[model samples]
Target: MAKLKDKRREKISVATEIDRLEERRSRCQDNLERAEFRSRKEKLTEKERQELEDEMAIMNERVQKLNKELDTLRGENRKNMLLSIALLAISAFFYYIFFYNEEDP
Candidate 1:
């Protein structure tokens, strides 16, 4: 089995991936913006329609990828939060059992 990554490293890895995804999304958005008020196809013929379809397809693919990346980021964040909570609880329990002695004893 692979060793589990520490929470900090996991967070950093997720953050890097998130940044890359956002960059790709921004590029896709830029492509669309650059194509605005202009024909995506070469001429006013079948080729032009095909070009438009291709652009649309690319845009849709990028959108889907971005959504997946966002979902992963959310999941990592949730895992980190839950892990922190669990650790805190475990630490408190240990303290109560050992270090937190009652003076009256």
Candidate 2:
């Protein structure tokens, strides 16, 4: 029973983590787009341009990292789902075998 609660908690935590990471990734993408538009639409000093470029690079790296993390989390979630399904199937099978005697009409 304790293990079941722990597993449920872990699953919820992973889902929450995935949601948080997705939000971060969305924000990063939005910032990156704005940066790109600013670079293309405005005239700026060399220093300003260099700074923007650096910022964009950092944002790009962050977005990549977030994407990788999200992928890993999603994969883990899939594995957990499969495991749960298998466990349920096994439990049902055992229950049927041991507790589900059929009555003849």
Which stretches of model 2 miss by more than 4 angstroms? Answer: 1-12, 102-105
Each model's lDDT: 0.75, 0.93
Model 1 segments beyond 4 Å from truth? Answer: 1-12, 40-46
TM-score of each: 0.62, 0.83
Range of the 10 consecutive residues with the lowest summed lDDT in candidate 2: 96-105
Candidate 1 residue 54 C-alpha distance from true site, Å:
1.3
Look at candidate 2 and tell me the lDDT of residue 24: 97
Model 2 TM-score, 2 decimals: 0.83
1-105 in candidate 1: lDDT tens per residue? 234555554556666767767888888877766654356433557787678768867887887879787888879868988998999999999999887675764
Candidate 1 matches the true fold with a TM-score of 0.62
* Cα RMSD of predicted structure 1: 5.9
User: How well is each residue in 3-105 modelled by candidate 2, as lDDT tens digits?
Assistant: 9977876767788989989999999999999999999999989999999999999999999999999999999999999999999999999999877866657
